[model samples]
Target: MSHPPGLDLGQLRSHLDRERPGLVGGPLSGRLIEGGRSNLTYEISDGTSKWVVRRPPLGHVLATAHDMKREHRVIAGLHPTAVPVPEPLLLCEDEKVLGAPFYVMEFVEGTPYRTAAELAPLGAERTRAAVLGLVDTLVDLHAVDPAEVGLGDFGRPEGFLDRQLRRWGKQLDASRNRELAGIDALQSALGRSLPASPAPTIVHGDYRLDNVLIRQDETDGVDRIQAILDWEMSTLGDPLTDLGLLVMYSARLELPDSPISTTASAAGHPAPAELVERYAARSGRDVSAVSWYTAFAWFKLAVILEGIHYRYTLGQTVGAGFDRIGELVPVFIEHGLTTLKDPKNSQNSQNSQNSSEG
Candidate 1:
């Protein structure tokens, strides 16, 4: 199982042939998808059906962090649940197959909106409905009983929040170059503002607009969420963290600066606040505490993006996105600071208390 300098197309096709046998009709066609920072994703087709293959990045990665087995198990467990996840097909732990561990799944075809502008063509009514649909999906995901879904063992239930904060904090420290005063300040603020945990729910680790897939059948009129992609970070944890991460990542560009613009409706996307209200109404979960979640989301995103920054500095990245991501760290830090300034908002205050006790 020698790791190739990059993806081996010939070997991949041979493996597919051996694995699926008569299912594939012809020789596979490979098209590499851009923008995945931590994994290699390939779109493969046999002239009839399309499938996706995901494997680890070319170099070193955290042990157990990108386990294809865990990802396959999680998606497979959630198949019968309401969460719209891709149908996983095969998982190969034998490193000899593709140089590193990889898994294959049904190729889902749909537009993944990276910004609000892309969501705009849906018009105000459909846009609002679509946002609500996203919330509904999250609610449905959280509502499923882990035991029934066979995901009760996703991760340790106790101390999930504390461990998350500590984990991200460590990640930030390890990836920081030097003299990042704001990074230090953000770490302190996050540590001090820790919220009590909510009843543990399935956390999507990276719940945001871009991670979702939408089916826009005009006849059906955008009725179903096609799939929720990238389950590498899925776990059992504080669900509010997922909500917070969404708000943080999709923060409106007017009052607060977010990496992905919420006003992207010109491009066709819903605003962040609208998305939040939709989620609150659908989930029946208190939305008042959303601010804290937003702040925490910023902290977590900053940490994650900084890891990309570290890689870019090491000359490991091949795309343009990672080149500028390091510059966004301060924007997230500022958002975190703004959130803490008004932490006493009645809605979020109650949530904080509830979470601390949970």
Candidate 2:
């Protein structure tokens, strides 16, 4: 069997037999799912049954951030709920099996549309419907009671917004390369204007249209969001933070030849106002403080992209776009400042954008 990078098929098969015997019917083959800049993911198969494996990136020494166990726990907790999540199968904490901790789940069939080009073939009407579906699904996700789903203790809700600002600040400092203008001002502004958060709920730290998988329904339209993938940052917190990120991504970003971007720049996508109104009407959540959240989203994404760029500078990253990722960080910082400075839709900073109960 051909082996994908960062995985040993023989060791994986042996571990599966010891942990989940009879799970595999034949030899296992695997392929790396590209485009993930954080945790590494793979599609593994036994020729009869297919599964997905998620693990930390190679040389990722921080176990807490890219923890497979945490991701598995969150997914399993939401399995019985209304949330559309891939069923968790097995979690391997032992690093000896795959050179890192990893988890397996049933392979879900759907499209995680990442770029405007990818969504173009679906046409304007379908693209518009698909993006709106993302917001509806988010409302559904935020509606779940953390305590009922056994996720009440997932994170610290009190002072969640404050801690988020400080945490991302430290993350930025860790990856500080060149002098980024307005970044300090944006951070200070966010710290000084922290708004009161709503009641706590499960927050999808990285909610976005591209992060979700969509499929066509019986009407032959993209109305169904099959699964909301990437739960590594799942936690309990103020839910509107999720909305802020959506707003940030919804902005029309014109980065000439920029490699890093979001699908919100696509045509036929709903305006930021429409998305917020939909959430407010359906979820009944107060989105007044959402502007602050969107600003924070810009800062958070800036830090993340900078980290990737930093790694690339050190020759530590592999991929086609890493070379150009650094160029996008300053752009994010600029947007962060702009969003926070806006009085009409100010939301404070937090990487995890949650929509709390209104």
Candidate 3:
């Protein structure tokens, strides 16, 4: 049997049998799971048991972007919390086993709901509940005390907003291959109008509907988030950044045959404002500065998408839908600019007022 690229069943079974002992009952069979644009994820089965494996993608990897240890650590820390995260099983840092550092976790059963069509079957009410649940779950995640969870040192939270802007700017520079209009302007605008971050908590760097597993409970027929996946970008940072990223994804991208997967167009999908209001009410954090954060989210995603597009050009990526990633970067940059300049942006207007008063 041909194992998926970046994974060897023989070495995996040997390592598991040695370290975990008796975890592997029968032969291992695995296949790569789709929809992940950064890390390479595979679903592995040992005839009786199933699990998921995660590792960095092949070639031209950005520094500190795909750390298996970091992802495993965050999930392990958040597993005990009310935050829905997959249970981490084993972490193998020894590259001899998988040819790269990798981690294993219990296979979570649920739908990621990438497109509106995927969510349409649940009806409007069910979709609304699921989306609201997304916000509530986020509140639950931000509510966790990082020190209590032993994640106090997960990331440097001091000056997080500025550092985040600089970090993403550097990432953008690293992936630069061609002229991207408005990207630099967006970066500069975000730096100029940085918002005051609340006390730092564990931030799910990429919190969106598609990054979580949603399963409808058979007994109650209520869609529930089973486990949150893809923690590669998680860290101890401004919690509002997560909310910002969520809000960015909540906005509809009007594009025909868009490469980016989004459920914002789904029937009954709550407005971004509703999600923000719910989060503010539940988390008790002032969201008045959310517009700036949302604009920053757009800029960050544009950089990330450009990085992916760069990787695709280098033939380093290992998935479909990458061919069109370049097309979305400009749109995201435009949104970032528009978000900051919009008269409805209370954050920007407030900042301007404060500056003038001072």
Candidate 4:
């Protein structure tokens, strides 16, 4: 019945041996995987076979944000496809075992390069190829038919964009601690300028280089995208929303002593425009509407950071980065406003929509 800070190793071992015996070789010991915010990931090693365990954060819960069953289902569904996802093993909903529900999956061996410095050893050419490969892999994911993957009803895609806007606005209200000047204007503009969405696909709610594990050859050139981690924000929605977030994260921010992980500033990494163009050519989706999506991505991230910052103020958050989170919230607000002002992207989106209608 005893539990560690996040997981109870003894209870977890008993549950695993009972439910999925022979999965664990011996007694279990685990270390928490750092750098993750929403879900707590632990590398559980039974001194022989290793696996990864995912569960919701300690206290605060965003209903859809850190779902164990949802993540498990999506990964299991994608296991038969060409998409790279860890093979899900067993899902345990019994809270008595670990104080919370959790799931186990095969451990992926690769590096999640978070900063420009981390990718530096790969050399510039390899870095470019690695990042472009990330785009290529994304195209593969969108190409998947939801019905084919047994995830047709994963989410209600009707009015997905409107739902996203309202959802984030509500999130902002929930965590509002002080005055943020341009945030409300930016939200209002987004509500007024919602673009007509295309057909829905499984959207990786947060897609960036760091969210994936990239395995490299001995030459250090990127080999393959080993696995796409963190499916908590994933659902069936506008695929362009994924691209927008990728592009937004592709641009380096000027946050001093930033706690956020970003690899956009790395040399040999393509610009946001290049990534958009590649996705358009490959996926054959309209790229014009992406600017609005990217702006919205900023707003969503700002609200999320504010939530963390609010939790930090209340002493609910753990780890080193929470202290600097509030400092980055307003910066995200300003960037969202600036991104919306760019007529080239937003106007092009509207024009593209009008053309399609005509």
Candidate 5:
């Protein structure tokens, strides 16, 4: 059987046999999982045993993005926690095995709702329960003490917000091709008003509805988040960054046929403010600076989309929907700028002042 690009089934089977003998029960067949624009994820099976694999994109990979080892590390660390993550089976750093570093984990059976239409079938009540579960899982993740989980050295949290702004700024610069109006303004404004981060925790850098796998509980017939996938950006930092990214996605894109994924427009999906309030009440972290973090999430996503667009231009990206990714960058930049300057976020200025002083 023909496997997807960036993965050689024969080599993979050979490696699995060597590392975990008898792990492969039959011939291995695989296909690339769609809807992932950053890393290439594959679902492989040996006729009986199934597994999921993750690797970097085809080409033009950014420097600090798509670290398979780091992804595996965080998942392994969190597997035992209340936060749901796939059980990491093995991590392979030998580049020759797959031409790039990759890892394998147990295949999680669930649906990653990518659009409003996909979520509409669950009915408003079920959808509401599932989305609220996303918030609760996030709180559970942030509640874990990183040191106790052996992830204390996972990231540098002291200057996290500043570093994140600078990191994504550099990422945007790296993907620069066309002139992105207001991107510079957005980046500069984020730098000018960094919020004081609360006590650091393990953050799912790209937390959203689609990034998680939701399975219906047979006992209750209620949809529940089975596993939180896509940990390529997981790190130790401001946990609110995760909430901000979640909130940004919770708002409707409003663009026709936008390539960005969101379930916010779905029936019973929680509002951005409601998600923020739930997180604050559960995590007990001051969310007063959420606007700044939300703006930063917008900036971060714009850079990410631009990077995907850049790779698409170079014929390095895999899968459909990439041709339209370039159109979303400008919209994200505008959102970031507007979120920063929104009068409702005037409290963010005081938060920034307090953070800078602290």
Candidate 6:
């Protein structure tokens, strides 16, 4: 089920003729961008203008999830708002055209940072500002009126948190390789300590630093967030969960027993607490209960990392990143365990209780 090298030039031209009408002309040139885990993306051009094409990965895809129509809808809904998202151009759900559903969007030009080391040249001040910009964007996103933005019906809002915990937990159980004692313990801990959440807000399911694109402006330092990539996981859910996941990936928590690096200087990232504080200040949202979110974040990450570890064990992926995933599993599990130790750290539960009482 390998994807076509790029947008099929002949088919693309034909599709343009019908849908877009004279937008794309002449032979098309395309370059593939690496590092996306789920979708197939390519930077395509006709030598004059550029565009991006997105389609499902080259293999069997779950029918219930990974729908191209949903991705297009999410991006399209965000375009009228302050959120920096790529503009969706065309959506083709007909499978005969590209072997699966596909969509095209304006090519957002900028550099994507995968590690803090890559951003080191910008110095701490500018890099921190850029990171804060992402936080601001998220604040604006959470503040948006989903009904006014035409995304109120995008996903199920009721019981979203419960569904998420159950869904990821099931995924972890189904993909386990060799018994992980910490995983079972963390699951039990999270289950018993589940928190209540406020009304569901739109959550970018996999928000992280790498998913944002940054560009340098000589006069004013780093400029605007050009675009937010990868909305496949966007949905109506607990917005704090998005913040928690960001902390899990971007924060440096103490891993006393693990050999992995625990500092920004060592692991090449900034502290998560600082980011959380920044978000709270800019958004005017209380983050005193963020610890529970952080714990849940680690739990979610551990499940994802363990799933990748299982794939690596089965010869699905070959690379240091995939191999190192197994080592990081225990680190994430430990974070979850530490968070669960205290019963008072239930951020979601408190929020739910407060809402119910109100």
Error of 1 at 121 (Å): 3.7
Each model's lDDT comes to 0.71, 0.84, 0.87, 0.85, 0.86, 0.73
Per-residue accuracy of model 2 over 116-185 as CA lDDT, tens digit each: 7888787667887888888988999999988887888999999999999999999989988788888899
Alpha-carbon shift of residue 184 in model 5 (angstroms): 2.7
lDDT of 4 by residue, 1-358 (tens): 3344788888888888899978888778888898785698999887887899998888746746677999999999998888999999999888787778899999999989999889887766777778888999899899899999899999999999999999999999999889998999999999999999999999988899999998976675446899999998889999999998998887768565678888765667776777788899999998777878989999999999999999999998788878999989888988888888983553233333322322
lDDT of 3 by residue, 81-144 (tens): 8989999999999978887889999999999988988988887788889989999999999999
What's model 3's overall lDDT?
0.87
TM-score between model 2 and native: 0.92
Tell me each candidate's TM-score.
Answer: 0.85, 0.92, 0.91, 0.91, 0.89, 0.87
User: Any runs in candidate 5 off by more than 4 Å, and if so which?
Assistant: 59-64, 177-179, 309-323, 343-358
| Candidate 4: Cα lDDT at 128 | 76
lDDT of 6 at 172: 92
**In model 2, which runs have C-alpha deviations exceeding 4 angstroms?**
218-220, 343-358
Model 1 residue 300 distance off true place after TM-score fit, in angstroms: 1.6
> Which 10 consecutive residues of model 4 have the lowest summed lDDT?
349-358
For model 6, how does the per-residue alpha-carbon lDDT over 89-185 read when each residue is reduced to its tens digit? Answer: 9999987777788899999888777754567676656665666677788888888778887899878888777788888899998897687768887
Candidate 1 displacement at residue 48 in angstroms: 1.3
lDDT tens digits, residues 162-277, model 1? 78878888888788784554767777777776667767777888776667877777786764578988888889887878877775654443433334344333322344565577
- Order of the predicted models by lDDT, top scorer first: 3, 5, 4, 2, 6, 1
Against the true structure, candidate 3 reaches a TM-score of: 0.91
Q: What's the TM for model 5?
A: 0.89
Model number with the top TM-score: 2
Task: For residues 5-123, write the lDDT of model 5, one tens digit per residue.
Answer: 99999999999999989888999999998878578999999888789999998873573677888999999999999989999998999989998899999998999998988988887
